[model samples]
Target: MAVTTETAETGLVVRYSFLWPREHDRGEREGRKDRPVCLVVPVNVAPGAVVVFPITTQDPLPGRIAVAVPETERRRLKLPGDRPCWIMLDEANGDVMPGSFHLVPFETHPLRYAYGRFSPAFMRVVLRTMAEAIRARQLRMVQRER
Candidate 1:
């Protein structure tokens, strides 16, 4: 099924071309690859915008903030449980739902599809962690074109 604005809720994991802050600063308009990203904000009706954090298997660099994905959660999302992954909370991408070019779809599907969604309990934890960063003014958001 296509990922409509209603389906693109907070905690939804979808494949997106997430342009990093550094990349945006360098004038690069596109991300290098399509990676799993967790939607961190609700899709607002006025602009149809949402915030997303990239999920990576690589370890966070020194002084960077990240949240480890639990093994149980990985299994639930059909991800490799043996490998470690984290949600990058120090930075995020802002994009519009329903019309974003960088939002990739599943191979078997023509429209945008979610890999899965994080449980509400886990999502709360993520939001709290992100809030800390936001309050500290440590989070950088890169707004992308729709």
Candidate 2:
């Protein structure tokens, strides 16, 4: 499907080059590699802007905020093999969609624009936890230009 702003909804999992906040802090302007990221705020929320939280198979280090992906959710995506994955809630990468340089189609499936979407109930849990992280001043943002 076409990855237009209208189709990029919250909970949608897309492969993206996510620039980490620490990387940005260190003067890096690009992400190291493409990885799965959940769309937390779609472009419609702030015209042209989208916020994506990173997904990783690695466990969260101490003091970091993250939410584990339930088995059902994992089954839905069929991702990360048998290893548990976590959606990092402590930070997000903000970029403009539809025209984002970092948002790319899967190399293995050029026509596909996304993996799948999280269930609405699970999405609510993600958003709520993210909001808490934001309120606690634990959330960091790396705004990507172009």
Candidate 3:
């Protein structure tokens, strides 16, 4: 279960939200549009917390997708200070051109997959390949730093 702090308004951070994955509502289903849907909630970035990066549905992005909060524009949005809104930041990859989100942000969680998505075996292979790629890039970055 996901835990969200009680906040009057949810601050938008990099086009993502804090209270996310709100249950589906077909009757309330919206027509095709471009926007990320989520609720408002409080976020606590405690010390010693290892931030977990959420994956995106879109692949071959310019960078890795990580959950981040708003630091600069929280006050302007009239949200509860700096809420922990989800954000996609490129680590090794840089400068992903912005695009429209038809619905919610394509988070990597599989529950919301299409009726027939990629097979399990394929998923394993893809994950392995990604792991290797990340390792190689990290090593290259270390070498460059040295």
* Best candidate, lDDT: 2
* Local accuracy of candidate 3 as per-residue lDDT tens digits, 38-92: 2212136432121111223333345443333233322333323333443332221
Query: Each candidate's TM vs. the true structure?
Result: 0.91, 0.92, 0.22
In what order do the candidates fall by lDDT, top score first?
2, 1, 3
Which pairs of residues clash in candidate 3, taking residues 3 or more apart in a chain or in different chains?
A: 57-106
lDDT of 2 by residue, 16-81 (tens): 899999889999998997888998665345776778899999999999999999989988887657
**Predicted structure 2: clash tally:** 0
Worst lDDT run of 10 residues, candidate 2, spans 40-49
Model 3 alpha-carbon drift over 4 Å, by segment: 1-117, 138-146
Better of 1 and 3 by lDDT: 1
* CA shift of 10, model 2, Å: 0.6
Q: Residue by residue across 1-146, what tens digits does model 1's lDDT show?
A: 46686787888898888899999999999999888899866534555678889999999999888899988888788753368899999999988886878888778776646788999999998999998988889899998875
Give Cα distance to truth, residue 42, candidate 2, Å: 6.0
- Best of the two (2, 3) by TM-score: 2
Model 2 residue 111 CA deviation (Å) reads 2.9
Q: Against the true structure, what is every candidate's RMSD? A: 1.9, 1.7, 18.3
